[model samples]
Target: DEVFTGDERWRGLPVPAGDRFAWEPESTYIRRAPYFDGMPKTPEPIADIRAGRVLCLLGDSITTDHISPAGSIRKTSPAGQYLVAHAVQPVDFNSYGSRRGNHEVMVRGTFANVRLKNLLAPGTEGPVTVHLPDGEQMTIYDASVKYLREGVPLIVIAGQEYGSGSSRDWAAKGPRLLGVRAVIAQSYERIHRSNLVGMGILPLQFLANDTPASLGLSGKESFDIVGLADVLAEGFPRGKDVEVKATRPDGSGVRFKANVRIDTPQELQYYRHGGILEYVLRQLRDAGR
Candidate 1:
């Protein structure tokens, strides 16, 4: 009893008291998320995706680890550069899992597995992609930055079992932050599909046994997800069939149908409101009225 009573090491620690906890701006471990930044009381209407560029073309069995790596951060990676710029040494740069609270790091770590093979940048491995309309080869994070700067939406094309490994939330959150508006894949791991919707990313599945290879999608064409504007106007019909048109530089295009992957009515509601966070915020704001 004396030994237990004598422990006063933490008694003098400071305790913060406030209605809203102040986030430390200088701390890299946990930063304020920008998910609700500029969020309006009501969501704008969801529109069709036009002229979307393929960010990466991946093969089958791509795991959540491939989408959001949790291992040691490379000194040359975008996430590493961010930390270094903030005066953190390479030795202090921790694994991605350890820094998950920081969106800046996690977003850069998306699709950054050292073993990942993005077919868009052939013969190269690990977080590399080719920016469209210029054929400029750069890191996936860099290309995403360029694409976002140019006001272009991004998409990822993949074969079967996409997001097949551990159910990591960052797998979905990271892609959404990288300006990836949609993912068209042969199949998706169940939880990852839900996560995608939870992050306000449209998940589409190819129809009629269609594959990107069968459709001759070279990953360089400009894609338009047709019927989304109409579907959103008509209330985002569940599992609606939508046409995808991939137009090449020559102006010729291939069209195919894909099924929306929003499975439940609640998921549809979340997607319509631009994600669960936004939906819940509006709900709370309106409830007081």
Candidate 2:
């Protein structure tokens, strides 16, 4: 084996002490993630998603590209605004994929593909959604912020082949950061479904030829996912049935049973810990103790 020489270009950079990392406090490309912020040694029990609002209603064949943080950051997009607020120039603004380490940018970039159409905002495209009850239309990130302010969990309603594309981690991570608690779709791309579970998002699949159109879900309802509390309390089982109730503005409701997509025991553990990252952290912490 040949002895390797260090690159001369970065030879003079100050190195961090011991095993510590030199985290930049103001770097746009790589900021600390909040996934483990205030993470307890033990994870709290996962709860049933109650009174969750539909963040968007999407049609079939929605790809990971439609959901992931990718492409160039627009000067007017939420991610761009964030960068501008942090004093980054428009000319210097990079692509969302290049800034994935910053949850703030990535979350704002979620569902923001210019070509992505949201049924909630018909005749329009990009990251736009109508916030529930008040029915105010705004950017998805803005609406999510308002929903989060009021402690409302968000869900996505979609048709067949949802998340069908390359396995992009930001596709799940962005939604999780945006407060998306669950996704009810006719189907899912296999890896994306697992990635959703890894991010602590519940992926529920429609049962028996059921579709959002058939269910009369107008994306205007407040939803309640029943049986999860009980199931998760005991122990999460693969393919458990959960009841989803969508209450419309008129107080009428559409109810249906959906199959929980946590398909394996290992995935169950990932969800129980609120995510795989948390599970690994807890394991390492416990092992050291």
Candidate 3:
């Protein structure tokens, strides 16, 4: 107590006088955000994702670093352009990790990893993806922007071991912001699967020996993940097989079985409510009332 309140070290520190820390424009520690709103405040249940367009088709071993990377922001990138619009110069546009407090920057930097190679844009490297049906070559962020504008839900088609790196929340958060409703992969890293559930994103796992290549998925297909809300509503057990159908534009498609990766009852509740954060906030709000 004496050391905390009466010590010379505490007193010698430059303390700004106030009940609250004064916010300033140049202070990188953002208080009143020049960039973002907090997570979804309105309590909403996780509804079934429908008619999701293919966002990206990636190969095995995709990592959290691919979802949200740490690197120099390119002047041509969306996040860089945003910072520049706000009068932040190119040098002031730091890495994604540095600007995480700013959601706008983080979301833009998502899938902007310098090494990310989206299979949809074969022979392309570094954040580029081919927007399906339209076939426009653009940045991943740009594709997501176009999808969002069209009210099209998004899904990521992947090879095995999706999200197979350090447990990073932004891997899930970034996808969610891009309107990704589900990730259909051959397998998932355990913690990343949970993170997906926590973020209200469905983690769908392919059946044994089946994969995007084996299933002939070109990543140009429109996918329907059926029996999510309905199965849950009808007392479906955890980890049950779900039926997924993918339809190409030419009226041809494939149907297959994928297990819902939601593991526990509590996680299911979080998924049902859109996310763990939203579920917790709603519970707190209800208790207060």
Candidate 4:
């Protein structure tokens, strides 16, 4: 009777309850499902994210499009090839847009299809080249894994409109998966920048013509964002300068300033919680109390 009354009340409301009102039926079905028998479920490991130390940035003339494409995908791309290699049914491979939900798929796709030449691979002086655990000239993805394994932090340096194009969350999600803790750029596209913050990746802006060239940063240099906790604790107000120390490949270091983009008190909460999803889920779980 309580269930029926709850359902009626839900349906009578102006806003649609959709599938939420079917929770009782769904729970019943889940209990009876064959695969529901004594399965061990593991919680997501949210505490493992440490601050990155070794920063790598690979971008080309069309870097923004590569990082966050405008739409869809062709069957011949690296992402498509990876899916095919894994025996994903042809239709299931789908568009890049559809596959963002899978971290493995998105990380493999990060620098796979970018037409711009990788700046950190061997035979380049642009930035220090990172050798992959694999013997190949390391792509950005490979190098990221190596750095992550070594317990080194990472940041991405980009030119104008760092994240442009579609509002797909994967554009930001992929970097977080790769262990990038921050991104410094000349400028950022609005939606992607917000998405980066949502994923708990610090989006920093370089002011006063402090381009990668001006700062002389290459892929080989490591970066440290000192006083990160202090900035977050004090509230990341606009015009707040966070110190970014860049170590060059030649063992020289340069110190530059970046503006913190954490614009609101709510955003600070998200950063403290590791991400927006974790923050919201924690809130929801607590609300039941």
Candidate 5:
């Protein structure tokens, strides 16, 4: 099956030199992404996600595909429309899997699945939510934009097997880009949970007996996750629990315990400084010194 020998060369062709790659600035595969602009600051080793808006209150069996979809981008969808508007023809609007290098596309494609049923937009499906304090329904990205402008963080409340299936990276990256600070679920597919930690998103598990339904989450409440920072400070131990206090519009509240799922020293470091990439970067930076 070899098309040619290793020594084969076309005449008059310029050779690529050196061990370093010559990165093309206009190439679709950008070696560096604008999505991750600044070096991640020294995160406060704190995991306290307080009073954030609920982007979605979902039910069980939520797969990675739902969190960050694959396959063809629908022509009218956010990612597709963005490509078209930028002069990429509808025919050239390829699968999200192929557009991974572009954070703008992937972030827009984050929850843009056709079958996603976010409880916030009852009886409707796909990547939509209600941005509150104003209660306007919009695309999840747009809602996250408004929330970001308002200096608000975001959270997703969900049922069991929250991130089941293939550990697609964007399933975590997309939400984090949308400013999702935490995800409290009945249980997590182990790999996906780790991926969340890798992306610096706190993944909390409800005690085996408690489900989102049992907590009476309506996708309308504001939440404050307490004790994360204290737990981390006390030495990142296994089986530690944090409390989630959810407040309704009427000022009523519900409090419950969730297992802090960070089971390793490395995972703790990753979570502390916002994610694995930042943790590694910091380590390399320090080591070089």
Candidate 6:
């Protein structure tokens, strides 16, 4: 039998020569190795949630059923029209619940709810009309895609009781996939808010009596969420204020404050690790030893 000497650091760690062992390799070796060879070398972490640079709000009491409906289709709604236009096979255009795994389908299906009247693209009397950069009338999802393609940051502003329905992971995953970086609402429903955090979507709350309308927020404005990393790091300890800088269409800006939804150290760790899924996977792998 042949024997290969393991690294000196693994001398008595019970690791066999051919088996895996934790070795602190030089930076060059790690960076140039086969597993990481194609990885982008950047000063910042690779899985940072803040990298998406967009924010999209979940409206008040947005149920998982709302995020991705679980019923028959009409063939004329946004999801239906998009599917047909894209040449998707009729049989393949299943319910939103079934297609949640695919970003393409979910992004197209977003904001497709029957009651969802896109304030930006309101069909009738409304507070404002959202104009796509192309000067065309389209659904909010289309506009979101345009913004995402333009590399502009997004943040969703919403009213009270946001995300108030069933516990659906896809509800959170969908927004993250859509390039939403944060969600600032007047209030949050317990499970949905945690789900947002689990999917790496920051959830912030307005102070008492503050709301999207109260702050004169419209879907048209751009927003910047400051002190996000710190808020996540500190687990959003009570009294910590999250500042939001909103840039209006005319280029003027106003600042508002929100309360971070993170309430515990475990949650902070989850956020730091880029959500609960990654955190759980890491734990599983570690325990297998």
- lDDT of each structure? 0.92, 0.91, 0.82, 0.62, 0.84, 0.60
lDDT of 6 by residue, 1-289 (tens): 3256667766667644656655543321121112122322221242323322223333466556665555544476556676677676577667876655445556556555665534455453211124433345555566566767787655666676777667777667766666666778778788888888787667788989787777877665666677766654544455677777777768876788888787667766666666776677667767897
Error of 4 at 14 (Å): 32
Give the TM-score comparing model 4 with the true structure, all chains together: 0.71
lDDT of 4: 0.62
Task: Kindly list the per-residue Cα lDDT of model 1 for residues 2-40, writing each as its tens digit.
Answer: 765445666566767799978989888899989999888
Q: Looking at model 2, report the run of 10 residues with the lowest lDDT sum.
A: 1-10
> Model 6 clash pairs?
53-153, 54-154, 54-181, 55-154, 55-155, 55-156, 56-156, 57-156, 120-130
Among these predictions, the greatest lDDT belongs to 1
Inter-residue clash pairs, candidate 2 = none
lDDT of 5 by residue, 1-289 (tens): 5655344465356767899877665544243455446755566547578778898878899999998887998888888887777778878877988888888788888888889999889888999889886778999888988898988889988888989999898899899988999998888899999999999898888998988787787768888888877888898758999988989888898999999888788898888777888888788889998
Please state the error at residue 126 of candidate 6 in Å.
14
Give stretches of model 5 more than 4 Å off: 1-31, 34-36, 45-47
Select the stronger candidate by TM-score from 2 and 3: 2
Poorest lDDT segment (10 consecutive residues) of candidate 1: 3-12
User: C-alpha displacement of 96 in model 1, angstroms?
Assistant: 0.2
Give one digit per residue, the lDDT tens place, for model 2 in 40-134.
77889777889999998999999999998478999999999999999999999879888888888998999999998999999888999998889
- On residues 161-261, what C-alpha lDDT tens digit does candidate 4 reach at each position? 76765566767777777777888888888877778888878888888778888777765555777666666556655678778876765678898889888
Better of 1 and 5 by TM-score: 1
Any runs in candidate 4 off by more than 4 Å, and if so which?
A: 1-64, 70-85, 89-92, 122-129, 132-136
- Cα displacement (angstroms), candidate 5, residue 156, comes to 0.9
29-65 in candidate 3: lDDT tens per residue?
A: 2535321246555645445666778878899899888
lDDT at position 162, candidate 3: 86
TM-score for each candidate, following the candidate numbering? 0.95, 0.95, 0.87, 0.71, 0.90, 0.70
Ranking by lDDT: 1, 2, 5, 3, 4, 6
Q: How do these models rank on TM-score, best leading?
A: 2, 1, 5, 3, 4, 6
Once model 1 is optimally superposed onto the true structure by TM-score, how far is the C-alpha of residue 266 displaced, in angstroms?
Answer: 0.3
